[model samples]
Target: MIKVGDKMPAGTFTQITKDGPQKISAEDFFKGRKVVLFSVPGAFTPTCDAKHLPGFVEKAGDIKAKGVDVIACIAVNDAFVMKAWGKAQNTDGKVEMLADGNADYTKALGLDMDATGFGMGVRGQRFSLVVDNGVVKQVNVEQKGEFKVSSADHVLTQL
Candidate 1:
């Protein structure tokens, strides 16, 4: 799994914007910036939609006030789904929703989780990272069926 001090791997995520869908590269996104990247098992899941994503949206200003350049939420759903979820969560100008549709980036970070038993296929585990200039500064990976550390409040303390 990705840990503190490890550099973010090469990867790409699909981001849907007002213009259209755009391919966002990890390099360009994290380069020379302090980013708060959070991942959810899947989009629109109970915990994710009810708490995970909403918490970040509520605390975005507080987080950015601490020098975070970007705050992003990633999931193993498609760009269209992510865009819709973002809208539903009212994440505009707060959190950037990134779609890792193929699980490529999640696997690259060693954070991919098998949810076949749950009929959700491969998904990224619930986790959060504070990455600065492409290198990880802090990491919070939640245990299965738990939402303790990888939360907006917890990350704020870390920052």
Candidate 2:
């Protein structure tokens, strides 16, 4: 897994907007910026929908007040699903819903979890990382089926 002081891996994530799907590169997104990047195994899952995503959405302003430039949520789903979820959760412009459809970015970060037993295939492990100008400053990764460290409140305390 990526550790503190490590640079974020180079990869592309998709975001669906009114302008349609756009490809965003991690290099472009994180360079010269302090960003909070959090990942969920899949979009609209129980814990993710009920707690993870909403916590970040609710605390986005607090996070930005600490000098965060971007607050992003990544999931192993398509851009369409991300867009819909963002709208449903009222995160339209508050959080950037990034789609790691192929799990390229997840695997590159070494945070890919084998959820085959759950019939979900390869998905990202629940994680939150603070990245400043492309380098990781802090990381919190949740254990299998757990939701302790990688949370908005926890990341806020780290900030």
Model 2 has an lDDT value of: 0.93
Model 2 alpha-carbon drift over 4 Å, by segment: none
Give the poorly placed runs of model 1, Cα more than 4 Å off.
Answer: none
How does each model score on TM-score? Answer: 0.98, 0.97
- The alpha-carbon lDDT assigned to residue 127 of candidate 1 equals 98
lDDT of 1 by residue, 1-159 (tens): 999999999999999877999999999999999999999999999999999999999999999999999999999999999999999999999999999999999999999999999999999999999999999999999999999899999999999
For candidate 1, the TM-score is 0.98
Pairs of colliding residues, candidate 1 = none
Backbone atom clashes (below 3 Å) for every candidate: 0, 0
